[model samples]
Target: MAMMQKTEILIIGAGVIGICAAYYLTEKGYKVTVVDKGEVCSGCSYGNVGVAVPSICGTLASPGIISKSLKWLLDPESPFYIKPRFNRDLIGWLWEFQRACNEPQMRRGLSILHEFNTASVELFKDLAAQEKMDFGFVQKGLLVVFKSLPGFKEGVQEAELRQKIGIEAEIIRGSELRSFAPHLRSGLAGGIYYRRDAHLDPYKFVRRLAEKTRKKGAQILTSTEVIGFEIFGKAIKTVETTRGDFTADEVVLAAGAWSSEMSRYLGLKLPIQAAKGYSITYRLPENYLEMPVSLSETKVFITPLADTLRLGGTLELAGMDLSINKRRVNAILKTVPEYIDINIENLKLIEIWRGLRPCTPDGLPFLGRCRAINNFIVAAGHAMEGISLGPVTGQLVAQVIGNEKPSVDLSLMSIERFN
Candidate 1:
């Protein structure tokens, strides 16, 4: 261990949340340092569907989650499949998820998500423009298409719930949906359109944000592992990292999938499991420059990037592991045929990535001061929303350190909810 250095605020996990936190804090005139174990933005924050979906306010464990599991459990390639791994934590997490899937819990969970996500949408747009970051942000919105009429009807009902909360949703017929973005194959039923949501190139988004933060004088130290923390009387004294020991007035734990281990080191019991997801990008064949679209029936998200069509979707409830499962990757490829007539055999796979989504039992992130210790705050367990919620999470973190009002009510997302 090296000798101790000092910072006004220290952030672990240099992904979107950590980077964003550093940016906001530094603007508030605080000395900040950000550290990460691996390459920055290589986690789930970098490679998701890339949708800032304020419209998707439902909990990960919804009313039909238990019922849906029955049909998906047998299919290895199902959207929500659980492996037969004999892991106690994974089993316990599933149980916790089931408990939260009740009717009342669904309403409560989605309501909370709605507020945070909506606030994040506005915040992210503001940051991108003011910071001059070209994150490929387009407010063209997302169109979810389906092949089954029943699925379309159900999706409309779900969109109705979003509209009730002031989210704009246009229930379009198959022809109308395709007309607005004519790229998918035929036989598409109707789907709900969330005009308020937006999408972006996640890779560009993170990189540009980090670049802008660095320009604004936020030091992002990559490959710096936080070995352990120093706490005294409910305040974080120092964070011991591989590079050096740094003392700070406050610290934010934004380590994503690796957050569970960090929480254990801090003596906090945060039940977060690493759910792995895979994405494959294919170069555009021709004239596919339309807005990104998601296939509702297959749970596949195909977003159009600057020069390629990136198709990614699949949630594997694995541990803190990163071994790429060939089957899961293939499952994502299988959805391509259902959506569009891509040149599958000839298309090049620009990348094959597997990042862990730091998932909680109820699909809500823990964001607040650690009750056990005041100086230690948590901003992890974001799961699939790490990128989408990064800006808002960062702003809220700065607010806490500044002793200001938060943008949204964080009662449900508080770390105390776990206790």
Candidate 2:
């Protein structure tokens, strides 16, 4: 066996969570090493609708989503679809997800998510200001446009609920919608404007952060796949990877959708499922979208990047597959012309990307120490909010490793919450 390399802190998975954790830990003067099966930000962190929305408090497991998912199941082009499978884990997760849809659980999940998202967005702003890492971060806010009265009514109710919970939201209708967002197509019923929301170029953000971390003396080993771990008593003593064995005083598992498989080495059952999503980037049109807009009725998010525009939506519960679904892509493309003055046929495709988001049954991320392994921390399960919550998750990981109190309550993020 080759002699194991050593570091003060070792992070698995070089996606948003792992990279952010590495950056923060390196800043804290820790000898950090980040290893991933693929290159940095090459996974779910890239190619997402880069909207930094802190005003969204509702979980994906919220009420009505189950019914919505059922209706979507029959349509291949639906915004959310679940492949029929006999996997026990998927079955268990669905049941728990269904149970978590009630008022009490939704409120509890939203409370934690709301606080984390608010703090994370501020942290992102601070990172941009302090580091001058320009990833086209914009704070122009997000517009959720509804074409039908029913959807518009739901938007109003959601806006009111968000307002009650200290989130900045406003309902814009008719003339105001036209004047405020002249870029949008005519005949929209109404829309909800979340003033606290923002958008950015996610690809640039992740690559830049990785570069910055390397400059600060953090070791990032891409294509280094972790295969096993050496556990002693209640702690991980060493991690065995395809490259070589490595030893770290502290280990963090932020492997996103792959964490469930990795956790087995430590005798842990992490109830995480891979929710597949797709995004298509196009060269900016002559009249590109001025800001981030979510087609509320279709569930597609249109985000304006520097030189391109991205349209992304759809959540498929079809375990770790990167294959593109043309129907889902078409569904997203079809929604564009209804809300805006863009013809899908005329757009030039820059890229088509698909990624699997790590999702927990309850819609809350698993953050903090593992019960079976004292030195190991799990920070996966952010689902669609990985980019939005990256920095704060990193900050929390650093605080946990430094033996300092976390900025927010860690009870909700407990790894053993399912147990």
Candidate 3:
């Protein structure tokens, strides 16, 4: 083993959260070190739709989500599919998720997520302006188009609920929706426009953020897998990796889907499971969308980034498996032409990306410090909002380490909530 090197702060997982933590800590003059098992943005951070949705900051474990999942269970191409497996964690996660599907929990989650995403969007704009980074950060808003009347009514109700909570949500019904956005196909019923939402190229944002952090004097070690840890009574003394041993005054676990396993090293239980999702990117044709849109019934997200278009959706709970499900990808592809006019035959594929989103059962991320470890802080389990909420999570992680009061309350994000 190489001689044990020390850092002021060491962060595991060089995804968006970990890299963002490094950025903030480095800006604060802390000697930070970031380690990742793969290249930067190689996980869930890369293939996401790159949407910054503040209006629809609702929890995944909503009241009707379980029933909806049941309907989708038989359909392999459904937007949400959970494999009928016999795993202890999956069963436990589903049970806990079901328990949290009440009005009270969903309301609490909406309030918390609203605050996080709102702050995150402002931070993203500020960072882009100050850093002069052009990641196609556009604030043109998001449109959720529904084809069925029942779906449109439900969507309108949801939009009204969001409106009541101070979000700018407007309904465009019937022919008004078609006239408002002529690019949409003829069969669309209506749509909800969220003016507060924004988007960017997630790949560029994460990679550039990593580059900026490295330039700010943070040490980034890629392909360095963390195998074990040396723990004292209430702190992590050393982080043992495949490369070498390293000690840090403070440590952060932001390994996303792998966080559950990483917590075991410190005798902590983090209830996070890998919720796999897929995205297919293609070179945009003429008259492509200027902004991002969501297919309400199909639950597929279509985003335009520069000259390319990306379509992504589906939540497949199949443990830590990284395999791509062709059915799910086809589901996304097939759902696009139903809403938008596209030439399916002439479409050229850029890449098919599949990633594991670290999801907590209650549809809330596990942030803040662990009760078992003094120097360790967790910043994982943001689920679908991992890309959207990256900046604020990083800012809060730094505040936690600096012994400063956090910008947002951490009670709801505690890792010990399961206990």
Candidate 4:
């Protein structure tokens, strides 16, 4: 090892969550060091839809999700899929997922997510207002367009649920749907417009925040993969990495999809599964959308960033696999033209990105400190909401490490919840 580097706090993972944690820790005057296996924002945070939607307060394991998943399994281009696997963790995760697929659990998860996302959006506004920071943050709201009557009905019910939770959801029907977004196709049943939602370039946000953290004297070690850990008693004394070894007073496991695998080295079993999602970015079309829109039935999201447009969707429970499925990508592209009046195939291509989002069984993230390890904390498993919840999660992690009470109640997001 190269002389055993030392710091007050060591955060593994340079994605949005980890970078935000470093940012807040540095602001708190803590000597923080962040190490990642790849470059900053090189994972799930890079190619996500980048929408912070508080109106989407539903859990992934909703009442009808199992049936829906089963139906989607038959279609190769379905929005959701679970590869048949004999893994013990996958089996256990499904069992927990099944248990959580109830109204009570879904409502409880939604309440927490609503709080997290709402608070994070405010934090995002604060970050955006900072001088020398511009990540294309825009609060133009989002629209969920439905093509089928059945899907529109379900969307109305979801909007009602969101209203009950204090979220503003406006239903635009008939000609109003096209009036809301003139570029949309005419056959749309309706759309639910969420005025509180916002979108940004996720990669820009993370990298910009990382730059600000560096300027604040925080150390960020890229291309440094964690190999193992030296646990003494109940605390991690040293983190062994590919480059060398390092010791810190506190360690955060924010390795996104890889957090579960990393936790095993510390003798903790985090019930987090890697959900693979794909995104296709293209050069901004002449008739670009003013706001992000979701295809309700197809589960695809179309977001227009600064100079490019991104179409992203699908949830594949393929266990850390990063391979891109051409059929699934094609399905997303094909579904876009059904709602929007745009020729996707002719658009200039930017990139096709695939990332593994860390997802927990109950559709909740694993936050807060670990029970077994005194100095270890977890901040992973945000799944699709990683960008939405990044800032708040980082602030909460800083609060926990600083021995201050967390702003939001983290009991529901306990790292040992599955246990």
Q: List the RMSD of every prediction in angstroms.
A: 1.6, 1.1, 0.9, 0.9
Q: Total clashing residue pairs per candidate?
A: 0, 0, 0, 0
Q: What TM-score fits each model?
A: 0.96, 0.98, 0.99, 0.99
- Give the runs in model 2 whose Cα sits over 4 Å from its true position: none
Model 1 spans > 4 angstroms off:
none
lDDT of 4: 0.92
Q: Which of the two, 1 or 4, has more TM-score?
A: 4
Off by over 4 Å in 4: none
**Sequence-dependent TM-score of model 2:** 0.98
lDDT of each: 0.81, 0.88, 0.91, 0.92
Q: For candidate 1, which ten residues in a row score worst on lDDT?
A: 177-186
What ordering of candidates by lDDT runs from best to worst?
4, 3, 2, 1
Q: After superposition, how far is residue 118 of candidate 1 from its true place, in Å?
A: 2.0
Model 2 over residues 116-178: C-alpha lDDT tens digits?
A: 988988988898998889989988989999999889998898788778888988889955787
